[model samples]
Target: MGSGQSAPTERVFHNEIPISFSQDLVNRLEDNLSTPDTTPERQNTLDNHVRARIQAELARLQAEEVHVREQIEAVLERENLDREKALSGAGAGETEGGREDTTSGNVSSSALLQGDLEEVQKKVERFHVRRQLDNHPKVKDARDAVLQCYQAKTNTPLDCIDSVEQFKRSVAEMERQFVDSLRR
Candidate 1:
């Protein structure tokens, strides 16, 4: 009506209009989608996916293990240096104790070095224990299995009963083995 062109239609709603398709085509699609997923090809695909995921997890754990090992080695080296310093300081004090002023200072410094060495040894032991646990195959496998179960069960750990039971069994077995080894 304006300048010989049709007027724009008045907008009724802000929502987008849904696309339409032929009902026959939609029915065919639904039928195809409803087919069972128990085919051998699908099973193999799932197996491959699981294998890839396990490999990725293993790689991540190995990297963490290496980093922890490096930290342990560094702590051990520092502990050794502290030990050497304390020994040398004690020797020097024995030679120089004729001067009363230096005797007190050397004793304090030696005590500090001994404390530092003990702290470093504790840190190294903690890292070593963590590395051992991380490298345990049963622990890793149980963790992975439980994680996968949780994912499959819609992020609910409570639904992973079998996995939790298996984990407990594995831990019990490990404890028994450790006890037997200790007895030996």
Candidate 2:
């Protein structure tokens, strides 16, 4: 009413009087015109019917989804098994003097062996310094001496050791030397 709008037309049916009352009267008039049976039991029954229908549909969809997932997993497992069998037959022809039918199996096995050889080569390259340590007399002597010192210090029980601090310092120095040697 404050917006300066014209008032709404009052709706009346079947020989009724015009309503010049408040908004609540319009609501009541509309409710009465709609239906006579607005009981709590009827409302609850409608709600329960809709809820049951939705629940049944949800269960049907879930079962279909589970069936599809199981089929996909089975197909994947079969493919993996076939691939593994092929890889195992890779070296058969070479071992049998080129007489075996090594198609997929031979190829996959050879590929796996090649991968293993490359990894071993990489490890050898990384440990080149450590592998050469055996040929150096000075490095070997120092390593043995440090290990001996550590073994002697840590050999006794804590209560039996007189100077725990001195032992700890010596052990720490030996550990530092071991790490420095590894770097070289």
**Candidate 2 C-alpha lDDT tens digits along 77-109:** 888667767545553344343334435533444
- Write the residue-wise lDDT of candidate 1 on 10-57 in tens digits: 767664878788999999788768985556988999999999999999
Q: Per-residue lDDT for 76 in model 1?
A: 86
Question: Candidate 2: worst 10 consecutive residues by lDDT?
Answer: 91-100
For all candidates in order, the CA lDDT equals 0.71, 0.65
Q: Per model, state how many residue pairs clash.
A: 0, 3
Runs in model 1 lying further than 4 Å from the true structure: 1-37, 91-184
Task: Name every residue pair that clashes in candidate 2.
Answer: 86-105, 90-105, 90-106
RMSD of 2: 21.4
Clashing pairs in 1: none
The numbered model that scores best in lDDT is 1
